[model samples]
Structure formats: structure tokens, C-alpha cells
Target: MAEGLRTAYQLEEDDIATILPEEEDKFNGEEFNKQFLQFDRDRIQKINQKGKEKFEQGYSKAKKEVLDQLETEARERFGVEDDELRGIDLIDHIVEINSKKSKADPTKLTEEQIKSHPSVIKLLNEKEKSFKTREEELKTEYDTKLNNFQKERTFSAVEKKALAIFDKMNPVLSSDPERAANQKSILINDLKGLDYQEDGDTYIPLQEGKRLEDPHGNGVSFEKLVQSRAARYFDFKKAEERDTPPAGGGDGGATGFPKTEAEYAKIVNDQNIPLEERLEIKKKWNEAKSQS
Candidate 1:
């Protein structure tokens, strides 16, 4: 009998365990197959309908929440009213309704309704103006305090200029001790005739040729003394050069530097080459000049 059943059904050994008599009833005929297919279709349709309904409900709730938040914010910030809010035409009503409420008529608006109505926008502008005015007042008060502080701690013109010179020189002095020393020597030689005073630790520049008695006045050389001060000024200039090195044209020939007459002038001026060399440079300048 088993051999006959196997021959008729063409079932394998694995299939035999799952093919129960009751289970076989559903697949035995075309009518049962049709009924099973219809049941599956009905189940799928029901599930889809339920999912769509839930999605629509959630979307509506979210939209309402967003609108509520926008309305609250607008009212607080700009004093916008409900009557001022008009529904935008071209924009999605859901998104527009969710946006900040403005003082405009929703019903009468045509294509592309203004996000914020004129009245609502004007109110917001007024609020911004008030904030800016307050900020300016605070700033003025702070500036006044700063000015008073500066006046209380003031330096003489010569002292101030000396400090400025020292600041300029400091960077150079820090970078190359040798170059700074050389510059200091040259400056002292140049300013030999100037009279200077020491305020605290700093030497202040004074009127030229005004001799003040030095405590160690054993025939002090005025030229040597002024030269020492000049060195500081020269060192500062050198330091500036070191800090901002020539851009481009390194050993690799990058050519990133500007190629123009104006740019050339800037480079030459910065290098501090002697006047004779500068004159010679102008002779060959056009030929060697880079095109802009």
C-alpha cells in the first residue's frame, strides 16, 4: 500500500512526515487552493488598510503639535494674532499651518503667501530695535569705564613712543640675538646726539642733542650711548622680517608669490636693500618683472 501511495503521489521521504491527512485536504483540489488564496488576499488587504489609517492619524497629530508650537513662539516674540495667520496657497497647507503664525488673512491669500504678515513682521522688527538699543547702551557704559582706566594709567609721549619701539624690537631680539645686537649698534650710532631718560627699566627718547648728566659721567661718549638705544629699534624691524618670511619661491621654486609691479615694490621695500641696489634694481626691473 505504501508503494502504491508513493507511486501515485510521487512524495519523497522528507515530504511524507509533513503531509498529514488533514493538511493534504487543503492542497488536494483546485477549489481548496482558490479558497486559501482568497483568504490570504483578505488578510493582506486588512493589514494595509489598518497601517494607512494609523499613519494618517499620526501625521495629523504631529501637524497639530507643530502648529501649536509655532503659534506660541510667534505670539511671544512678535505678538502675532490668530486672525493675522493666513494659510499659504502654493506651499503645502500642512507645512504652512505648522509654521510660525503671522498677522495675515489666511482665506484671502493668493499664490505664495508671505510667511510673516506685515504687521507681525513690523512688531518683530521693533523688538529687535529695542534689543539693539540696549546693547549699544551697555557698550557705551563699558567704553566709558575703559577710557577712565586708560586716563588713570597714562604714559608721556616720549615714553609711549619708546615703548612702541621696544615692542617692535622685542620680537627681533627674541628671534636672532646676533641680528638684534647689530641693529642696536647701528641705532645707537644714528641717535648719538639725542638726549634720553630712563623711566623704570626703559630708555625714553628725548629731544635731539639735549645732554643730561649721566651718574657715571667720566666723559661719557654721547654717540656711543645713543647708538645703544638705536640698536633696539633696528632689532625690532629685523624681527618683523623674520616673523613674515617671503611667501613662495623657496628652494623648491613654488612661485606662489604675487607676480606684479605693485607686489614687487612691496617685496623690495620690505627687504630694506640699500638705495644704490634699489636704483640698480629699477634698471632691470621691467625685464625681470612678473606679469600680473
Candidate 2:
């Protein structure tokens, strides 16, 4: 033995047994290779099987979803509600119905068949309700307008005739352009106060809801009636005074107060004299005449 090295003779039995192996205990290369190869094969097989199962499951689910989508689209396009018919059979039924509709003549359909159609019924209902109502409204509107227009025309014709009569009643209006319109307006208002209204092309004067008549029981012309009432309304000249002196010309003298009937006429008829001053002269002349 080398120095400091323990020999077999000097070591304990337990220590020697611990360091050495028995003859029956040893490694085997062939058995290890067989077990490792089997383990690898089993693992690979399990992974492949699991992948196949996942693929099958996914394929079936996707296929079912596609089929369901196709059925929904087909039903909407063909407006089909037959739950029993599906896929190609449903498509064929939709095509056959379309073909029948295309081949049928719309004009040959009976009234009941036409009424049963949804779109046709909807259109007919709308027209029946709206067209008649709209036509009535338009007719009423047209009638009202026509009535108003006729009334306006009659009124205008009567006014024109009345104005012509009034012009004859006050001939001075033709010469006095400035006061003619105002005076005519006043006269027309007075005529209206006598219950004047238009009857066709003529003017009617009503008294107590009856047409005014002359003593002869004849219908009194508006001209004659207005002429009879003219004196009460105004002291206007029916015709220019025969050779009367011009206004403000020695008619009233220095005081401008008329002393005689002729002087009063000249003063009142004078357009040159202001209306207020003429009215005042008339009032004073009347007072003086009453006292006399």
C-alpha cells in the first residue's frame, strides 16, 4: 500500500460494500433504448390525435355556421316562410313561385285577387281616402273664390253707375279736381246710409227691407232718388250758376257775409274761398236771415 492509503485489510466491511457494486447490479444499453423509443412514439401519437380531434370539431362548427347563414339569406331573398323546406328544395320552390308570377297576366286578375295584393291594396286605400278629400277641398276653395269675385264685380259695376249719377247731381265736381274725390266719397257714404246695395248691374235702394218706389208705384231709378235727396246733403251747384261773379269778388262785400240768396250762392260755390270761411259765412247768413 502507498503511504496514507487505506488497504482492504485495514477498511471496515460496511465501507467496502458501499464503494463497490455487486455482480448482479449493472447497466443495459438495449433496454434503455427500447423504453426511450416507446415513450417518444406514445407522446407523438397522442399529440397527433389531439390535433385531429380539434380540427374535426372546428370544421364541423364552421360548416354548420356557414349553412345557417346561407339559409337565412335565401329565405330573406325569396320571402319564403316554409320551415319544412330547406337548402336546394327551398330555393327550387322560390324559383317556381317567381316563374308563376312572371308568367301570369296582371290584367287577368279578378277584383278580389287584385284587392288581396298587399301593394295594390295599399295604393288603392291611399287614393280612395286622399284623392276624394283633396278634390272636395279644392272644389270648395274654387267656389268660394268664384263667389267673392262675382260679388266684387257686381259691387264695382254698381259703384260705377252710382258715381255717374252723382256726377250728374253735382256737375261742379268735374271742374274742381281737388275737391271732387272728397265730395264724391262723402256722397257715396250718404248713399250707403240709405241702404244702397248692388243687385246684378243695378243699384237698389232699400227702405224697411223693400225697394224704394215712386208715387206712381214704379221702381225709382237710383239717379232720380239720389237727385231728389241731393239738396238735403249739400248746396252744391247742379249746374254752373248763370253768369255768377267769380268767388271773393264783391259777393260778400268787405265783411264777406252774403246779404242775398245770389250772394250766398256765389260765396258757397266759390272754390277760391276756404271751406271753413264759406261754412262760417253760411252760418252767419242763416242767423241774420232768421232774425229778419
Candidate 3:
């Protein structure tokens, strides 16, 4: 119940467990709580009220269904309309919405039948327009940002000297666009922080401290951080690629895909993997549904 309530209200269970109890014991209830801790009387009252309600309701089926849906949406973690999985649910959603009409129609409805339905077709067309508009927005924004960054000459010295060292050190970063961007950003920051001497067409890099902040803000060597994280991103990107199915639907062959929707749901709900990565896996999962 404690964990469930924490999740339902987006409370930090670890924060409460580690910090709240200690603070409670350390101070008297009559004394004012510290503002930084964010554990004021009203907050605690709200949590207690919700807990009382949940306890009285006893996790009813209606509440369970709502919670399940909220949990699923949270897991979906849908980002901007990437072209790859562009509105895969439009067909399913439309079919569900027009189930009665579909049943009464003489024509046998195929999985792709939504393509022919007037309403479905219209919605899809509009979504495509939206996709294009969003794409253009992204492109214009990216170009503007890139131009500004270039004009600033923020990384010119890094590009001159340490870029070669960075390339030699973090080659795995080149495999994916996101990884490449992250590596570039980190290396530029790392190099800029370093003390450098100007030479002919090159730079001599030095710094008093031997360590630069890792991308995660912990201390580590730039080479070490890039080597470790680059390898991880490479593996993750490769797995993402291998998992993506061809848009023509699942291949007319077996490929170790999840055999049932239940299995797919289990995988999709997995909180261990990154949410975006899990969503990509859900996109590629076979459409098989479990008997249960």
C-alpha cells in the first residue's frame, strides 16, 4: 500500500524512506519543518487523505482499471511523432470506435481496412500534415541553433587540438546520431575547461585538475567516460535497430518475436529498460495475442 500510494501520487518513496523519517525523529512535530525538505503540514495532510480514501475503497476494480491505464500511458513514454512508429494505433483506435459499422458492413474488414474508411482516411491524412509541419519546425530550429553555436566559436579550440584525441578515444560514439551529439557536447565542454597553449595549426592542452566532470556530473577521465558510455550507447543502438521491424508489417517468417500480446505487454511494461527503447520494442513486437 505504501509503494502503491507513492506511485499513484508521484511521491518519492526513497526520499521519504531515507530522509523523512530521520528528519521526523530529529525534530519535534511542533517545531517548523525546513522549507527545503518540502514536507510541510499540508503536503502530509494531502497524502494522508489520499491514503485514507484508497484504504476505504479497497482497490476497487474501477480504480484498478484507471490505475492500469495511467501506468500503461506512463510506460508508453511517447515522444514526438517520429516517422518510424508514426500513428500505429490510428487503425486500431478507429476500428474500435467504429466497431458497429464495421460489423454491419458487407465487406470483410482486414487489419489494413482503416486505409479505405473515409473517417479513418481523413484523420490519417491530417496526421500526416501535422507530421510534416512538426518535421519542418524541428529542422528550422536545429538549423538556427547550429548556426548560433557555430557563430559563437565556442568549440573552435577544442576542434583544433583535442578533437583528434577525442575521435581516437571515443570512436564508438559515431555509430548513432544521439551518441555523436552527446560525445561532441561533452568533449567540447571538457576541452573548453582545459588550459591550452596556442601553437601553429594545433593546440597543447593542459589543466591543473586531472579529471573532467563526466556526462552524468560524476568525476572521471574524459577518455574513460567516453569509452564506457560509448560502448553502452552502441550496444543499445544496435539492439534498437535489430528490434525494429520493416514497415511492410512483420516479415513472412519467424524471427524470435514475442509470440503473444500478453508477452509483448509484459515486455512493454518493463521499467528496467529505458522508456523510449521499450516503446521501440513495442513497435516491432509481433501482433500475436495470448489466449488468456
lDDT of each: 0.44, 0.56, 0.46
Q: For residues 56-175, what per-residue lDDT tens digits would candidate 1 score against the true structure?
A: 565555555555554555555444345455323212343344343555445666434444545445444654565556556655655676555333223322333443454443434432
TM-scores for candidates 1 onward, in order: 0.22, 0.34, 0.23
- Candidate 3 per-residue lDDT, tens place, 94-150, comes to 454466644744245675765776766665565456555655665565567555544
Indicate which candidate wins on TM-score: 2
Where is model 1 more than 4 Å wrong at Cα? 1-27, 79-116, 119-292
- Candidate 2: TM-score? 0.34
Question: What RMSD does model 1 have?
Answer: 36.4
Alpha-carbon error at 192 in model 1, in Å? 94
Model 2 ranges off by over 4 Å? 1-111, 116-123, 171-176, 189-221, 224-235, 238-292
**Model 2 RMSD in angstroms:** 52.7
Write down the worst ten-residue block by lDDT for model 1. 249-258
lDDT of 2 by residue, 1-292 (tens): 1111124123344433433323212323365346434544564476557755765565555555555655665677668788778755664565556547789654465656645656445444654555456556655655676566455545444555776676544444544645766766766666655555676656787777788888889887777777766556566552335244337543432235665799678767775444445666666676767887
Clashes of 2: 0
List runs of model 3 lying over 4 Å from the truth: 1-90, 96-99, 102-107, 154-292
* Better-scoring candidate (TM-score), 2 or 3: 2
